[model samples]
Target: MPKNKVYIFDTTLRDGEQVPGCKLNTKEKIEIALALEELGVDIIEAGFPISSPGDFKSVSEIGAVIKNAVICGLSRAVQKDIEVAAEALKTAKRSRIHTGIGTSDFHIKSKFNSTREDILQRATQCVKWARNFTDDVEFYAEDAGRTDNEYLARVVEAVIAAGATTVNIPDTTGYCLPHQYGEKIAYLINNVPNIDKAVISCHCHNDLGLATANSIAGAMNGARQIECTINGLGERAGNTSLEEVVMVINQHHSLGFYTDIKTQQLNPLSRLVSDTMRMPVQPNKAIVGANAFSHSSGIHQDGFLKDAQTYEIINPEQVGADGSKIVLTARSGRSALAHRFQKLGFQFNRNDIDVLYEQFLKVADRKKEVEDEDLKVLANQYQTATV
Candidate 1:
C-alpha cells in the first residue's frame, strides 16, 4: 500500500532469548539493542516486559538509551501485560507495544480452551489498551498460518480499527510451506478491508527449514516487515536470519522492496551476537556463515577465479566477509593451486606450473587438505638449489 520499503524488525533479544539455554541478562540485552541499532534495524523488539522483573528492567533501560530505532516490548492479550509493556516503553523515543494472542483452532482449544469469538474479543481489547499508551502498537496473531483465513482477516481488520500500526502474521509452528505461507499473506492482502492501514509483518520460525524462504515469499506477496534474529538464533530451529533477508533484498533491489540494514556490518554484528549469546552460527549458513564465501569444489573455484559472479550472487565484501576463499583440497584444480602459490610469492611460468601441478595433485590426493607447508616443500623441490 505504501512505498515498497521492507521494515527490518529484529527480535533477537525477545523471542530469540526465549530459546532454551539462550537467556541474556539486562546488560547483555542493552548491548544487543545498541548493536541492532547500529546494524540499521527499523524496529527492535527488546523483550516481554511483564514476563519477569529482569525483562521489564531490560526493556526500560534499552528504551531509555536507544534513540535511533523503535523500541518495542511484547505482551500477551491481557490488561496487566499491556500495562507493564507501556510502563517499560515509557522512556523510548519511538516505542511500540507488541500485543496479541493465538487465533488457530488448536491454539484456541488446546492452549487457551477459548472459543474463536472470545479470542478475537481479547485480541481487539488488548490492541485498544495498548493504543491508550502509545500510538505505535503492533498486533500479532500467533499461529496465523493455520488459522482460518476468514477469521484471521476479521481479527486483522479489528486490530487495525483498534489503532494497531502494524499487524504481525506469525508462522508460529513453522509448519507451512513457502507457497502456502505466501498464499496466506496474499489472502489477507486481498480480503482484508483495512489491511492497507497497517503494515503486514512476518515472524517465521525455521522448524521446516523454510523460514527465510517463507519470509521472502511474504514480502513478494505484500508483507512489509520481517521479524527475524541475528545468526538465525531463536526458539527451536530458529527464526529467519536478519543477514540472509537483508543480503537478499540488497542484492535484488528490483524486487521492489528494500530495508535500511547496513549490509557491510552483517558479519561483524552476527559474530558479536553469536559470541555474546553463545549461539554458534552454523558454518554453512547462507550469508554470514564462516563458509558461505569459501570455495572447495574444483569447478566452483575455477568459476570464482574467472568471475566472482559465476558462483556468488553478492560479493562477500558487501556482507563484511572476505572474498572467495580458495581452500586447497583433493577436489581443487590447477588454477586454484597456481592462485594460492602466487599468494605465497611463488613465480612460476606456465611450463613450471604444469610440472608442479602433477606433483601438487599427487600430494592432494594423498591428503584430505593441502597445507601451506606441503606447498612450500613442493615449490622448493621443483626449483634449482641455490643455497
Candidate 2:
C-alpha cells in the first residue's frame, strides 16, 4: 500500500462482537463481513479463531468467500492460538494472522502475572508463528496506549524484525489522551530502527470519548492503519467508530492522509452492523445517526433554513443520509416555519409569516411541535381571515 494511504482495518466482527448480547452467528458475521469488504476496508479482522468453535467457523467461512479485502483472524500469543488462526485463514485469497500480547506493566503484572521481558518474547514469537501462514501478518500490542514509549519501541522493533508487516498499537483501555497517544507513535517512529519495515496501526477504545481523536492523532503523527469497528461497537464504551474516523479524514483533507473507504457506504454499513448485531445506534451518534444532520433549536433551525452549512460541516449526502432536517418544535423560529411552509406549497411574506408564526407557536406550545399539516391549517386560517 502507498504511504499516503491509510489502511482501514475493521474489527467489527471481532472486537465489535465482544459487546455483551451483541453476539452474531457465523451467517450474520459473513453478511456483515461482505458489506465491510464493499465498504473498502483494507482488512477485516474476522474473529478470534481459538476462542470457540463458532468463531473458528465464522473466520473460516468468511475467509473462503471474501475475495477482495484481506480476511484476518485474531489470536493470542500461544502457539495453539496462532495455529488455529492460520488454519482458519487458509482459504483467504488475501489473509493476515493477527496475534499479540499485552506489553504494559499493568497487563503484564495483573492480566498475565508475567514480567515485561517474558511478555515481549511471547509477542515476538507470536509474530513469527503467524508469519508461517502468510506474509501479511499483523501484531497488536494489547494496552499499547499505556505501554512505556521506550519499552514499547523495543517491542515494536522486535516484531518488525520477526517479519511482522503491520504492528497495531492499541489503546486497549481507552486511557490515553490524543497528544499522549500521538507521542507514543511518534516515539516509535523516531526510536525504532526498523519502523519503516512495518505499517503502524492504531486500535483505540472510546472509554474516554477520545477514540476518534486519538486515532486521528496517531495517523497525523505517522501511523498508517487505523483498526476500528462500525458504529463504534466494542467492549465497554466501544471502539473507535469507523464512520467518525473516515468522515474526519474526508472532511479534513489537509491532514495529508486518505483511506479507500466509500464514505457513502458508511451510513448503510453502520446500520447493517447495528441491526445485525442487535445494537441500537444512539440517535445523536456521529455521521450515521438519524439526528447527525437534524436541527431543532430556534437559532440552529434559522441558520439551517438559510444555509445548511451554517450548522452542518458535513453534507448529509456525503455520508449517505437522506439530507439535512429542520425539525419542528416549540423552540423553532419563524424562519423554520416559513421554510416548512414553502416546502408544503405556501409562500408567505414576512408580515404573513409573523402572523402564521404566532399561531404556530400556540399550537407548538400545546403539541410540543407544529406538524406540516398544522402549519398548513394555520396558514390557511390567516388567508381565510384576510379574504
lDDT of 2 by residue, 189-230 (tens): 999999999999999999999999999999989999999999
**Which pairs of residues collide in model 1?**
none
Task: List per-prediction Cα lDDT, in the order shown.
Answer: 0.91, 0.91
Model 1: lowest-lDDT 10 consecutive positions: 378-387
Q: Give candidate 2 regions above 4 Å deviation.
A: 1-3
lDDT of 1 by residue, 75-161 (tens): 999999999999999999999999999999999999999999999899899998998999999999999989998999999999999
lDDT of 2: 0.91
User: What alpha-carbon RMSD in Å does predicted model 1 have with respect to the real structure?
Assistant: 1.8
Off-target runs (Cα >4 Å) in candidate 1 are: 1-3, 384-387
The TM-score values for the models, in the order shown, are 0.96, 0.97
